[model samples]
Target: MSGYLADKNICCGCGACENVCPTKAIAMGYDDEGFLYPSLEQTKCVDCRACERVCPVKLDANKGYPDYLKTYAGYSTKKEVMEHCTSGGFATELSQLILQKGGVVFGVRYAKDYIKAEYVCVTQEEDLKALMSSKYVQSEKKDVYQAVKKTLLTNKTVLFIGCPCDVSALKLFLGKEYENLFTCELVCMGVTSYKIAEEYKEYTEKKNKAKLTFINARSKKNGWFVPHLEERFDNGKTKLTTLFGSYYGYGFQVYNRPSCFQCRYCDKNGVADFRVGDFWGIKETDEFWNPNGVSCIFVRTERGLALLKEIEERGFKLFKTDYEKATVNNMSSLHNKAEKYVVLREKFARIYKEEGLVRACKKTESFSVKLKRMLPKGMRAFAKKIYHKLHDKKTR
Candidate 1:
């Protein structure tokens, strides 16, 4: 075990590091404020950098997340772009363009049927739809490295879209000279657990006395869809879950992996030519409220900027607006939250649940719960926020 970046800008919050950690020293830990960050059982660390190699941040640490990381408001006219996207289908549109130009784009796809993540290769237009929308579950696209390596061997360009860690893994696995790999990470707001989905299925199908039909989860009215839910009934009726609905955050929290509380990868570190996600603040422009929502866009390089412009010209939607940062984007805010909560996760893994931790982190359906980042101090603040948010959301 070696040290690695634990902040959100770099950490994809993927649990690879925790499992790969040999000493079992790296138990998932959380700070008091409530956000989870990895605390090292320094004794377990071999300092081999095995954890480092798999780190999305350390792979391109300095360049991985830029200090001047800026935001952009871009869009797509393609109805499908709006329909299928979590935010704007910028990622999908861009990915399709890359594939159309004889390139391969790699990104996480919502296994709607399984409701888990499966990394897929998008080479055809039809494949693009499958990859669109946010899964909310953790991406276990471990095959990404192999798929990318194989795609790159062909000499065609390859665009890999994921959280920072996924990109970092590609760089680490392929060596430093991955010329054809275009990496894109999202402004991750932590991940939830698969337990939420699994539990939902179990409770709905087994206990609810009704056939689980479908989920129109999240509160958004139109635009892109988030973890939309659908529960069907034999009478042909269905029910939906709002973003702040009873089924999402809290339910997810109850089921997320124990490691999530001690997640070392929850942080977002820079690693893509272009970073993209939902542009949350703006209500849908002309389009209906995007449930999956608009993709929040950030360009860290000229290459990213150029791609944005090209995609815009290629007929994606475009708008100009002042961008903002949530706790998700502010590193200082994260550090501030880190203090009191740092070691909580260490204690938690012992109690969070022994066997189900890893399984829960991979699927948010259990709780739509995943790990969020914070320094020890920040964790305390997060607790207050969660208390209030949950209280407020639950009552509403």
Candidate 2:
């Protein structure tokens, strides 16, 4: 049988193959694209093929989306949480519940270098802030599967939040379900490489003449509808710019891992106990909708439902909704498919490698966007308004 991890096109870089290798022969190493893939040392090979058995992609075909026990559109009642979180603060609240029970939370956060995102364990409420928002970049998961297993064996409750692939990887590594373990899969569209984030950091610093101290991929300071990237500099300066204006944000769809376009775990097909994402399609006028933010939650297992019940008791507001309504504007909440732009993405990757992110933007950005860039600052906003009006009419 062909090695699943050997095929770069299919590997989600979840590190399960490496983690599951019995001889420690397989290790995760980056490709030219800066995405991780399992590499084997033939000398240490035991030919055990443990990696193959644990591969999520290999096992994905037979497991379709199971019937969900309950679905809801909800938000945390806490005002402070709503202000800081990406969506309805469900993730934060849920993590708090686990921590309150003396359990540990596993989630993503930026490295001290601020160039890479890595999965880390948070045991205290004060440390939860680092893991509160989305990073958008693929996170490094070195040895975390082992750490999670160690914690679970202690009979403590654990909450693991990650992209579908990572959650699957962890579960497959354990090879058995722990009653105390709660897995929440973030609804993912795609994840870009950390290399892009590194380049964008340099680009931003060069443009602003200040080193970045922090970065938030999706900041809701302008409110939920108009999200912006927030950057803080060592010079004590702060900047909030539209996603389109940022190279990393604009190229997010363009620079995702190759496996993302052909993702097998999209929609409700994953192994997570529950799923969470922003409630996109619900209109502001809808009663379930919250102007601050709302999260679409899918509770699959009874354990997941029970957890939600406890959270509700602690002030979470949940309004029951069907899968159809919850995913109308946010199909990615249940389905993950990228728009057709394979050739453009390829071209962008080439330009990005040769000339850097700024040049890639100039070459790959849509003509309408390029035209807007050429317009004066005042007219650009006016043009944006007119375009949105026409777009809203057509979509209606």
Indicate which candidate wins on lDDT.
2
Candidate 2 C-alpha lDDT tens digits along 257-341: 8888777776677788888888876664678877688899988898888889999999999999987777765645655464566
Q: Candidate 1, residues 189-278: lDDT per residue as tens digits?
A: 445555455555665565457665444343233223333344566567665433433444444434333333333333344556766665
What's the CA RMSD of model 1 in angstroms?
9.6
Runs with alpha carbons beyond 4 Å of true place in candidate 2: 1-6, 334-339, 368-396
The window of 10 residues in a row where model 1 has the poorest summed lDDT is 366-375
Best by TM-score: 2
TM-score for predicted model 1 compared with the true structure: 0.65
In candidate 2, residue 50 scores what lDDT? 80
TM-score of 2: 0.92
Ten-residue stretch with the least lDDT total in model 2? 372-381
Model 1 accuracy (lDDT, Cα): 0.55
